[model samples]
Target: MADIEFPSVEWFQALADITKEDPTYRKFGRLNAVIVFKCGDKHISTNFDVLNIHEIREVGENARRDADFVIEMEPDVWRGMLDDIKKNGHASLDWTLNTLDLRFDEPIHRNELQDGFKADMFFRYNPSLQAFFDNAAKIPTKFVAPVA
Candidate 1:
């Protein structure tokens, strides 16, 4: 169990460690994309390539760049997902990563070419990502204090 916060280098490292051991993740046919997460003033970015996660970088501020996906949310929403992951061995219907992103009314950023390709990866390797996050159930987390 880990006491890491969401959108932190430690959190990303923990996820990467879990994913490395997942056979399902290995079957994903090599994913190479950058995912950026933003919440209030916190920003974290990670690069995944060849099914290997690398470069878990913490940035002081959001920068303009092309990414496969850019997830922006309130810190509380992010904490809820982590708590759900801890409880259910996976995110629940309302907390699923994709679902959470869709629930946001504003437009999210994604590079059409890269993101479109990643969408294919999602369909092709849905189970793997599911399994990857499912491993979160084994990790302990502290929910971030919600900002008003």
Candidate 2:
């Protein structure tokens, strides 16, 4: 299979496919949340429903407001995390989303509606979210070039 470009629908879909087969993911139990990824100018959303990833697609800028929470990060940070995942079969403790949230000054876990309860979903279901992205290690992924 060709290397899927990161931050694209195809790339995310590939990850979702792998996540579906992972029994550990199911063990983490069900989660219903619309999580948005803010990578540079891209707005990618994934709806996690009933223990499976229901949908993953690019969305309009304003569409992020509809998600339960948004993880806003620079494109480079995402690349770094993926690279680590590929090398180690998963993100190292430091590169995990939970760790990143604490390391960065900008809140990666956020609620567009300013609902604290919704924002906490990122943590509540963190193990599942970590497992979802960890599957990226199983895929051949190519990072997109940075904008000049």
Candidate 3:
């Protein structure tokens, strides 16, 4: 297991590698879009197009992009989700990705597609995403400095 930090290139690469091998991920079809992960003052933007998952690019101090989703949360929350993945091979109640994002005090950005068609991708291909993160269960993770 790899000790990964949120907003780090290594973490995103790990997820990409895992997703590529997951059968469920292939079922999700091709997805092309970028997702920005922001925690406190640190920001990392990752691009996922087709089956390619790029490294996390530091975009500190830059304006946000027009992305499919913008996932923002406290550093501790991110660590908790990874910890949950490590324990259960999947995120549970308090650490479910969607649940965490929804519970965040700040706004979570998503495409304005009608009826949340864009957001539905998470549900439609949940098994794949779950499998992707489940790989984390096998890897060691290092906690980043938490925000208050």
TM of each candidate vs. truth: 0.76, 0.95, 0.74
- How well is each residue in 1-148 modelled by candidate 3, as lDDT tens digits? 5467765767777777777777766776776666666777776677767766675576753434444555666777777788788888878877766566577674344443323665565565455555666677766677668344
Cα misplacement distance, residue 64 of candidate 3 (Å): 2.0
Q: How many clashes in each structure?
A: 0, 0, 4
Name model 1 segments beyond 4 Å from true: 62-66, 107-129, 146-148
lDDT score for residue 39 of model 3: 72
**Whole-model alpha-carbon lDDT for candidate 1:** 0.66
Clashing pairs in 1: none
Cα lDDT tens digits, model 1, 98-147, are 67657878533444355566545444545655666677776666555533
lDDT of each: 0.66, 0.88, 0.65
**Candidates ranked by TM-score:** 2, 1, 3
Task: Give the Å error, residue 114, model 1.
Answer: 11
**What is the Å distance of residue 146 in model 2 from its true position?**
5.7
Model 2 lDDT per residue over 55-120, tens place: 799998889889999998788889888889989999998899999999987778899889999999
lDDT-better candidate, 2 vs 3: 2
Lowest lDDT block of 10, candidate 1: 106-115
Better of 1 and 2 by lDDT: 2
Q: Judged by lDDT against the true structure, how good is candidate 3?
A: 0.65
